[model samples]
Target chain A: MDSQITLSVNGTSRSLTVDSRTTLLDALRERLGVTEVKKGCDHGQCGSCTVLLDGRRELACLALAVARDGVEVVTADGLAHDGLHAVQQAFLDHDGYQCGYCTPGQVCSAVGMLEEVKDGHPSHVTTDLEADVELTDDEVRERMSGNLCRCGAYAGILAAVRQAAGA
Target chain B: MRALDYLRPESPAAAVAALVSNPNAKYLGGGTNLVDHLKLGIVSPDELVDISRLPLDDIQEYDDGGGPGLRVGANVRNSDLAAHPVVRSSFPLVARALLSGASGQIRNQATTAGNLLQRTRCVYFQDATTPCNKRVPGSGCSAREGYGRYNAILGASDACVATHPSDLAVALAALDATVVLLGPDGERRLPLAELHRLPGDLPNLDTTLGRSELITGIEIPFSPVAALSTYRKVRDRASYAFALVSVAAAVHLEHGAVRDVRIAWGGVAHKPWRAERAERALVGQQLEPDVIGAAVEEELENAASGDENAYKVTLVRNTTVHTLLQLAEGHR
Candidate 1:
């Protein structure tokens, strides 16, 4: 029940054979050694395994590795090739982590969330669905509710996202 | 997790054929809910037909000989469906319900058809060690005597008291949507209200779909009431939580009286509880608070609850009246 599949991980074409039951998070961490995506909850409740699949934020724990064959996966490690990405730099400047267990997911989620905002996706707190969405504190919190920081660093994370969004 | 074979069919017909060939095979959609169950060892499908990349991801307007309406493909993601221009303008309740259910990342991965087929979030069902009639037939239901905060209060059988968890299904029920399916025989359409089943003797059966049937798309007819409808969910938190009680309502007013209305309740039953009695009571009546309260009370006349979840009855009534009053104000 193992299939050989190729995924474009961080702009590199990497090929590996994965079992049908292997999750994308396990494949990226155990098989390919791309460990930027953390596995907090194998269930989809916690979003610590958030990754950008084809330039959109999705939980790797819920996706089967075989089903995502040939998909473009950009992890938190792939965000900065030469230098620190803007969101990562902002996280460091704002002190957005205590033990740094959820920082990778927070950064990846922030990066993808900004793209969604640019695409004008509305959140639960959005009052006007027709108008373009602005990245207010409520909007960011609602959009990032998937990733939980157990150390209670949400205030600093909120500040960092606002700084990165130029709001 | 158990080992399984994965198949990717190129077409919907081929997918149905693949399912018909294997009795223990399942059609995989976004992998949000089914994968979780797989990890929990709750289900052990021998094969998974990955239908996520099929050509069923378009959201277009169609005339199905009934009237002009929107035809949403089965593979359309929840976030994309909520943000679509036509859905936002014409069916705001659908968009609002979609946004209220899950987080941004989960919504990006969950599909329209998958959301409809999601299982109840009963704690006993998720835990394999516990006894759940929904997970194992003839087994005892743990939620009946355990912490029953999320148990159903309407249309519940003695065998099961779990509630449906989809906010989107509640809105679609109020909108009178139709579900399209493709099976080994041919194509068929089912009313959205009739798609889900009340837990009678068989708590294991969640829907009326055949074993080899696959959802192709959903047809949502156009209506003036649906265009201005809205959804309100009362959950444990402001966001990222399942509803304790939720209401989806659409009102059409004529000469300061109720001309027509549609109502549905979530987190109250095995399926989306369509408030037909309440809708009948409100027709030709003034949109006053007392009238709304009376109508909702009549609908909840048969509501039964235990001590742990008795608050849901009052909460559902208040939520419905508040939502209807807001819609009435908007219409004025």
Candidate 2:
């Protein structure tokens, strides 16, 4: 059941042998010693394990490491590689987290969400599907609904996302 | 979770062949639902045939001299399907349903076929300790007498009352979508409405899919009504929660009268309950509150509900009426 796989974490390449049941979140955190991606619910329900996989937002806890061979994974820490990402900077400025446990997920989700907005991805609240998408407050809230902050930092998170999107 | 073997097949044929040989194996899609089931000990498959990498992720336009339509690959992620230009423009209901179902992260990881095949989110079915007939054959359904807030209101049997949880399925059902499958014998197509099964005496079987049958894609024939459709989900919270009652409606009005309409209700049935009777009643009729109400009532005539979930009957009716009225207003 153990299979060897390679993952590009941040800018570094990591090779590890993981079990078939080893989720991407566990592979990144336990096997590769990359703990920036936290495991909150371990189920897809909580977005605490959200990460950018190949530039798309995905829940790490629900994905198997073996299934994602050679995929590039960018965590919240990866966003601050050279310097703090605009989203991370915005979060800090806006006080996006009372407790930092869910901050990583919130940051990663926001980054991916902004990219989606740029790509004209429509959310549930979007009324005009034909028009270009704007990073409105409702859009941000709907796009980031997967990630939950127990500290009730949604207000700050929303503000940070808007500021980062330059809305 | 128990350790399991993983096999990444080169093609759909190879995938089906691999599964045909192992009766204790499952086709791994996005792993959003199956992995959670693995962690919960709800299922124990010995092998996972990884079909995520199969060349079945494209959303293509096709016409077999029948009519213009779309063929959505089974491996297409929910988010990608939702954001696809064709899906958004030609089938906005699908996009809306996909967005209404899960969080952005979950949708990005969930596949179209996987969303259809996902097990019920009934609290009892999720708890391995609880006696769920759907999870284990003849184990006895705990939801029948337990917290029935999310249980079925229609097409339920004595054995089970768990409602189907896919918002996309409800939309597909309303749009008269068809499922394309590649089985051990050969490729075959089935109507989307017939894919899911009502839990009768045998609650373990969720779908009519044969063993070793791989869902290759879904076929949605283009329609003017479908182009003017929408999905509305009513849940406990605004997002990330399953529907309490949802409606996918497509209304085509002609000169202030209903020319055609398709209606499907979720969170109130074992499967996506296509409101054929409601559609029958609404066709050629004016889109008025009384007319919509009467049509919805006709559809709910056979709808039976438990004590805790009785509200779903009225909720689904109101939701259907509200959704249809909105669509009718848009048409004007």
Candidate 3:
């Protein structure tokens, strides 16, 4: 038997009817028809299903749709209304992706990564924890490694992230 | 994967009740582990008790309480715990390990309890076509002599050879943390070092946790050496990579002599290898490369490395030596 799941997408809240086994990725791509939330491996191994859950990047493939009742989910489609987010615009300008399959996840993940930096969150690569972290290629690459672009546009993606971060 | 029921429990007690009420209930934390299993058909639970709604997100030190230095909640995300003030200040080994192992996206979602309960990344187990002891009990491990690249070296039998993949668990083993389990009766604590068991004859039974039990949190005792801790991982890829061999080392120096030491290895055993045998050799001894390497080597001398994974022996040695040296150097 299916159950009722309430979720907030972008600024709109909806009572979604879904199965317990429906992944958040499936709920977005199939049920809600938000194709921007891509599904690559449908596993945690690939970050293609990355989405913003309460402003934090999480694997939609790993999340069950039914359990996330009061959660606010933001996808790439919902990230922008007119043109694009700074990171998305930077990605397009720098050619961060070729096939564009993993770009949504990459951009969403970057948003969360940038938030982490702004919150003074230290990464493993951050040697001096108390020092200011520059979002260099190494930092961006390390942070964005989860979003795998099979076209191998890592340099461009790193450049995009760096440019977006005011490099 | 087939469809099932799901519920986001409000508290640990509710999660426990959900599991107890339903024989086919499994608690979901990060879903990085359980969801993967669900898709792979390795497990098919009738219901999933969502533990993410529980009030388990915390990382604390019990110094004022005169207890162990650290306690990590089960629902605590790996990234949050890794970046927490207490963890960064007191448990750098764990933070370093967490960051080194997973990609930033995954680290943000993977929780401490889920990471601990994560199954092996054995090709056979994931494939499901082959006979595997972990996937199917008494089904004969295919990795025993076939493509055993990441198989266990320390704890292995004719049954299974899959090594636990979570690099963070290795640091917890070194920290000597205690896991808090919530069940029908109440809560019970078990040492993190004692959580995982060697896959002797029962490859399916990885830990002592029961079906009705939920890992509520992990409590770590305070250690003066926590500040001087380090984690070193060697893998194929630079990031988002599983460890070929990883080491977590922490040391306390008192007048040039090692007053305390904790060393653990990942991708070496079915569980995180808590090298207490090696740790004992460092206690009261000077932190020398040769001495530390010798001590670390003593713990792995009996390791039965396969033909495919023979390089792990050298890999483990190098990581162990490097991590120990880094921890020692931090003191100076």
Candidate 4:
């Protein structure tokens, strides 16, 4: 059965009726017309469907739209205030994308990664959990391991995260 | 994927009731694994009970005088459980294993219960058209004589050779954790070791959990030695890949002699292969390379392997020895 659900996406509240099987990625793309969140695998293996749920990184392909009703969702479109957000601007300035298929997911993942650092959440590469996480190249790589760049733009992506972190 | 009815139960009792009422229902947790199987047409559950909203996400300390312990709720996210200070400090092996299993995005969504119940990645079981005993009983196991690269090398039957793919469960087995389940009858607990069963005649049933049972939480007993434990996973990749062979080891030493040790392995068995023989060898012996190597050798004496994954035997021995040595060094 299809049920109506109201959600806050990119600071915009919208109500829609969707099937129970409709994933968050499908609702974002097919229903709300948020095409930025690409569905590369639609099985949570690929990070092309990454998004921010309540300010934390989550895979939209595996998340049910009905399950996440009323949760705050922020996509690449919501990151900008006046112009491109700092991370988006940094990606553009550093040439962090080649074909641009994984750019939105990369950008959103970077934003969530930065928040994780700010919140003192440690990564696998984090040697010392007592100290603040340094935004080093290795730390960034480990934090962004979920998001894959098939075009091999990892060097540019790493540089963008480094520059955005003011490291 | 087939159209399914979704129910979000407000309480644990209601969740159990909903599952008991519907025989063709599956409990939904993070959905990182279950959703993928659904899309692949591997499972067609008529109803999905969303238990994410249940009040079982807390990680509490259960210090009952023996030592400090942890009771992790079933709904606790993998990322949160790994990052919890109690787990990081008391049960480092559990934290490391959880971190080594999946990527950041999936970890943020995967739950403790779902990780324990996640199915294997056998290609034959994934392809519905093929014959897989796990997917459908009486369908002969294809991986047994086909591509057995990822198949089990320990406790595998001719009916099925698929391995259980959870790094967290391996660490829990080493810690002597207890699985708490809520059923229609009432609440009960089972040792984590007894939860998963080997694929014998019935390759379809992966766990000993009853049909109407729901995993509420996992309780890890407090142990001073578990503080010095660690997990070492050897995989095809550094992250976001399943293990080829992984070992979770915790050791305690006194006067250069081993006081206690617990070891469990993943990616090499139908369940988390607990190395009791190896632990017995090190219980009263010195922490020497030869001693550890001999113990590991004794543990793998009965391991049966196929032509493709015979290398896992060597990998298991090397990992077990290396982890024990590392833990021994920590004490020194």
Candidate whose DockQ is highest: 1
Two-way TM-score contest, 3 vs 4, winner:
4
**Which residue pairs come into collision in candidate 2?**
none
**Predicted candidate 1, C-alpha RMSD:** 1.0
| Top-scoring candidate (lDDT) | 1
lDDT of 2 by residue, B239-297 (tens): 99999999999988899998999999889888999999999999999988889999999
lDDT of 4 by residue, B1-332 (tens): 88889999988889999999999999999999988898889999999999999999989988776456789999999989988887877888888889887888998999998899999888898899999999999989999889988988889998999899999999999999999999999999999999999999898999999997999999999887798898889989877789999999998888888888999999998899999998998898987788998999999998899789999999999988888888887821
lDDT of 4: 0.89
Clashes of 3: 5
Regions of candidate 3 where Cα sits further than 4 Å from its true position: B63-68
TM-score of chain B of each: 0.99, 0.98, 0.95, 0.97
Best first by lDDT, ranked: 1, 2, 4, 3
| DockQ score of each predicted structure, in the order shown | 0.92, 0.87, 0.72, 0.73
Model 4 stretches with alpha carbons more than 4 Å out: A129-131, B65-68
Tens-digit per-residue lDDT, A28-121, candidate 3: 8898878888889887777898899999998988887876777899888788868789999999899999999999999999998899988877
Model 3, B155-198: lDDT tens per residue?
Answer: 78778888989888899898878899988999888888889989
| TM-score for chain A, prediction 1 | 0.98
Between candidates 2 and 4, the DockQ winner: 2
Q: Sort every candidate by DockQ, greatest first.
A: 1, 2, 4, 3
Which of 1 and 3 is the better model by DockQ? 1
Which tens-of-lDDT digit does each residue in A85-122 have in candidate 2?
Answer: 99999999999999899999999999999998898889
